[model samples]
Target: MDGSISTSISSSRSSPLRFSHNPPTPRPLLSPTPRLTPASAGRQPSARLRAISPSPSPSPTTPQQRQQEPMEAFGFDALKETFSVDVAAAEARPLNVPLAAPFTIASSRLEAVSNVAVRVELSSGAVGWGEAPVLPSVTAEDQPAALAAVARACELLVAARSAPLGAVLQDVADALPGHAFASARAGVEMAVIDAVANSIRIPLWRLFGGASNTVTTDITIPIVTPNEAAQLAAKYRGQGFQTLKLKVGKNLNSDIEVLKAIRLVHPDCSFILDANEGYTANQAIEVLDRLNEMGVTPVLFEQPVHRDDWEGLREVSIAAMEKYRVAVAADESCRGLLDAQKIIHGNLAHVINIKLAKLGVLGGLEVIDAARKAGIALMIGGMVETRIAMGFAGHLAAGLGCFSFIDLDTPLLLSEDPVYGGYEGILRENPAHLQFPFVNVLLYSYILQL
Candidate 1:
């Protein structure tokens, strides 16, 4: 009926198969069956035929194929280009006064925490600040040596055109293989990252991928008499601390009495008992069982026994899980990922507490990842440090969301923190309000001028 149909019909009329005069009596009104080609009639469409075939993939170029890739591609080079530490712009500051006395543990008392402030600057005029309070007994060093080591290392790295922080550390470690101080190394490393992050204007937590913003940290009430411990717990509780970590390792009875006293005032606060490697496996079990009977369930028992006693640790872990339904955490026993791997392979504990001071920041991150992959719960704990170091630890805590507990009470333990407002000082009198005479005028002047 349409012109196109007429054209088709006219064309068909010219062909040999077309009917002429009566159009073959006009076929009965019916739908025409589709004609099938010989190639298609005998076969059904396959799944392979039904699926969409993508265009042929382009072959990789020879240069791309030859490039050697890092095992874990972190976009590290991008980070390096993004932020570089400037060695010459480094600075240091002195605390208002030496930290207060009677810094006691269950086994020993400390007189002072010699504090030094460190700052690392980038070529772009960005600066990162850090604080290192020398803990001679804990880190096996004194204040002067630690400060000198840190300054010397900072100079060495800066003179080398301010290499990537990791490369700088590797170079320093390689150069001073047997002489490296753990505290000094930690101080410098933290300052470097801080400066770099400041230069890039990114929060340290976001740099690690939005793991956490604010984490609830446990406040440690150092070992004291039962009455004193109760007062300290009440003070911290009044100040809005929900979790309390009691130092417990000198005398089991004294520790129990102290725990009982604190419980009387604040029964709802969660507790973590840190023995600091003071008990034997048997002693740990006895103390834990007694605590359980007293109705004070610790969220975790940290380093109940000595560091090297793997057998003791395993036994304690099994006993704690079976008898008290409590979990054991390994602290001093872990040094790196390998240490974590060994402990996990042996089932030494239910959780692993990672200290960035013990394992360098990057190394600590690796260990955390390894522990997570091995199905162990993680805790981020810190040594006694300044707010600068605590900032680094806080970032790590925020990055790793699985951490069940955080022990970042360093600021709460320091008697005087030079940085002041960012963190709460331990002393009743705020250290920022006090001014001290020049104990190190030359160093102070040099840093201030920088």
Candidate 2:
């Protein structure tokens, strides 16, 4: 395989791949599916596997030696000037499913689900797809504004007039007046990484230097009445999901009932809890004690209190460890490495959940490294997104082998996605596998301004 990087977007193709909207013309707004042909099928391992196992590790060499080392070149010649067709605007979907309460945290009410889909074309005139989900509950008023800003930015980016990723992020930050838009900024950052990976004819995981293709993931069955939670756990067990995460904090008795039901049905499956920052320090301690009494040991308890309740979390963590032997995992409280460092320094939590959308691509990497160094367990997670977004998460999960669990069920949860031809795309009965050639075409067109 050619390792030389191709910075130019235009290139020739040896095959053609076809794509079509699944339900014909009218409902075509639903994610487009790509059809891969024998000609386009190449038996190459993902790039992530290579990145993790480079032949020579970087040592404490001189700066000259470090600079002299051959860097892995990303081939992008086939991605120039590919996207020409305007995307048809679709009505935004509402993301207001209520979590069976006392589980609601951070905000009193949850509202809309926002998403963005980016299309790429390959040299063979084939099209490839990518997407990112933006959650309004976290982003607040910044969601729509960030999307608009990114759309405008992307238009210029595709035309080769925009700055580099870091520069573009700085520009976006400068243009925005505040920090309330990090969630929205995360979406655009994810989209750009996905686009760059596709343009280079590689899976997102490979782009991140992952060592494996398949990574174990945890299936999250939402917080519900005990019976309902048990039933959901059983269903997921039947579907090959071995690890399960339960949403807690409605009420101590109610939460225990749900755990009891799940333990009875799937006695062997690993378990975790996410309070979504719903617990008080005393309440969290009481619940952990009760769970221990029942012999129901969870791997970790995530975000047991409010995001700003650092003292509360510390109290809860100390109580759980001293009394119940349970460990705490910071989710909302540990937004990125900086937060993770504070939590580590304070001995706040034993583990941390790292969501790519919450931290952006590079920021997520920094958090993973920090968590590893701090001896904290990591969990790779995601919001509700399409296969495109899940693809990126899967790659990251695989790359960061230290993650004790994975929560990448977004694509499986989505009713429909905008683009196809990825891991989930192939698994579906109706295969819409976006081929490398198609991705190359779109990228080339975009780069060339065709």
Candidate 3:
């Protein structure tokens, strides 16, 4: 969790988690299953990626100057020593997938997932995949914009000749900076990093931190009617989903009713209320008060107010923790490292939701490092995406083993799986648990479950 994060490349394996009888269709892979051998008993962990030393340039005197300064590249000397990556080719394309049902939330409604897919091929013939997920009102870019931005970024990546991996990544970040092009930036980063991991013959999880190979997630129930909520809750309970994240904040009365019906159906399940910036400070507190009256307490309340309402966020956070002993999470309010610094210094919320599409991988890592030092909890969520993006996130979450709450379940809501190559036995039988298979064999594709 500190700045000096080292990598663990363990070969010892455990039996795969038992999944349902029905599994997704398996996609072909370019390489065969990877072989592994147990490390020596006394072997020591090696450092892979680490924070780079500060530059010799003069420090900025003003806050605006500091904000405008580029983030220093994380030293990847370990990667360079092991192997060099030459960006042979890259491409981006429209990735549109049908959702199982309409995904309705506080701010937006969607019948399908419109995203951008990115492919990065190394000169060594190793390939990586990424997805830029677009959620209207949440993400800065729509489908067309994401596609165009990613295409431009891919062209830049291809134009670079034998650049260091870190420099190549920094160039992508420079091209797609801030929320305006964060989704595109994240997609390109994912592809680049995944390709690096493949080139070195290791899984992304191992390349990240190797904390754990699996991550448990909570299923989501979007804003819906009381009856529909109850049915979905019951169905998820049967599916062995222990936690349910309810999307609220559109209508107070309707939200309360839906919660009541869901509670009636699945009384034992824990709840996470994600308002998605739908309520005011007072309304957020009132919802908690009513839930307490019904003898129901959510484990967490997410983004109860708008992103810019810092004061309201702090007020709701304090009230939620003091009165109900429930944690408030800042999702929309935290779009960058500056916002993370504000929340940390001002004590705005108990948890910060880390979405790579919003902050990109490097930006997310910087926030995580800062939050860990400040003793704040973390949550990893994502826009509705296919396995390409969600799978990349799952590797980081599992490898870090630091997130308090995991909400990477959007792939389950998709009607069909597009990019797929993973353990076929791993399926939605236990949809809450995500099992990351060996990525070394998956040079061309990757899959992370719901």
Candidate 4:
């Protein structure tokens, strides 16, 4: 309901969607990452990082440093006033986007993700996009349920009271009480926000006060052998990444060995060990103790115990903090504001990882504000989402300049780039409108089947 942004939404649900447990065919990792090309980079000045060197820079890339070169070189102004738009119609666009490679997390192995997207058409004839990656592992909501939730949410927006863009999106979010389809509701919310922000002729960060315009996020390494983990860490390090998130929980000893392998290869890089609720409280404590003996501590220890084991979470967190002086964060345990409150009030976590799927732009902001009020740290994160969702999170992380942690690096794992523009440098406007720079990279054709 903030007056800075304006838009409206809602429509009837879509029909006959299919859900699949089968993973999409994995694409080979061949395409180079999408960066601003001189001809296509917009005519605008990008943000810059404070100080960066060949050596590991603690700060991530800033807005000015986003593009390979500079936006001014191409003369692309992302904020150039396009046209004002009154929301006309909103529709759900679902696609089972294939991953460039198979990604194995603690929960399961995924060859592709079901990306449920929302396309908004405005009165000015400008179409805006918003997307939420559906992953049962993260939000318990799958593709069909997510698409249906967006459809139902859109229907409510059609009849709701009209207001500013932010407010309308908030209303759209409110329509889904108890987060019946939390991620799906978020898709609608983001679509509206994206449309309104773009329509206003400014970056989404500016609408949010444009506090900080740059961010650096940690790339994740799923459970792998110690040797593989080390080799992977070296590759990411060679790519100039300074932080690494290693997935733990399969085997405590093996996880420790993985950490050791990475540490041996890249000693200066910061690390975040995420157990994905794969460990018991005692196991979590034991690992931390063992790591302390190794004399190297992670930047943070995430979700060390089962999602519902509040006592276990608190025990490990407190023990890690008291004994090892290491901070602990809660991911699966903290979904929205209520969980955030419990984490803060109950002192269950030193930090909270706010992923957009679990909390849309608005809901994510509210949670960030709550964490700030309580002096708890935040990590702006997202699923293996394309530029759409990560773009939104990056804006907030850079604008607010508050998150001590960021995990918006999943796109690096993808072999394709499905979105053209959203995040400043992370995803740029590909002048080729007909197709993404990499064919089928950003295009979701399965959406048309509906």
Q: Highest TM-score, which number?
A: 3
lDDT by residue (tens digit), candidate 4, 1-450: 111110000011212111111223323222445332111111111111111111111223444654342222110122223322356787777755567567777776778767787876666554556676777787767888777878877766655554556456556767765445667767776666566544434445444544434455677888888998899888766555566888898789998888889999888777788898899999999998888888777767888988789999889877877776677888888877888898888888887888878766566777878888877777667777866666666665654667666677666566565544232222212111111111111122123223
Cα displacement (angstroms), candidate 3, residue 18, comes to: 12
Ranking by TM-score: 3, 4, 1, 2
- Once superposed on the true structure, which residue ranges of model 1 sit more than 4 Å away at CA? 1-86, 91-101, 172-180, 420-450
Which residue segments of model 4 deviate by more than 4 Å?
1-85, 158-162, 424-450
Q: Which ten residues in a row have the lowest lDDT in candidate 1?
A: 34-43
The digit string of per-residue lDDT tens for model 2 on 327-364 reads 67788787666788888788787667787666765567
**Largest lDDT belongs to which candidate?**
3
Tens-digit lDDT track for model 3 on 1-450? 112110111123334332222233345332222111111011111111111111111111244754564432322335534445588898888888788889999999999888988888988888888888898687899989998899898888777788777778888989999988989899998888888877765666556655555666778899999999999898877656667899999999999999999999889778899999999999999999999999988877999999999999989988887787788889999999999999989889888899999999888999988888887778889999876788888778866767777787887787766655642212233232456545531354643221
TM-score of candidate 4 against the unseen true structure: 0.76
TM-score of 3: 0.82
Checking candidate 1 for backbone clashes, the offending pairs are: 212-398
Clashes of 3: 0
Compose the digit string of candidate 1's lDDT tens values, residues 284-305.
9999889888986776788888
Give RMSD to native, each candidate.
26.6, 11.1, 11.7, 11.9
TM-scores, in order shown?
A: 0.73, 0.68, 0.82, 0.76
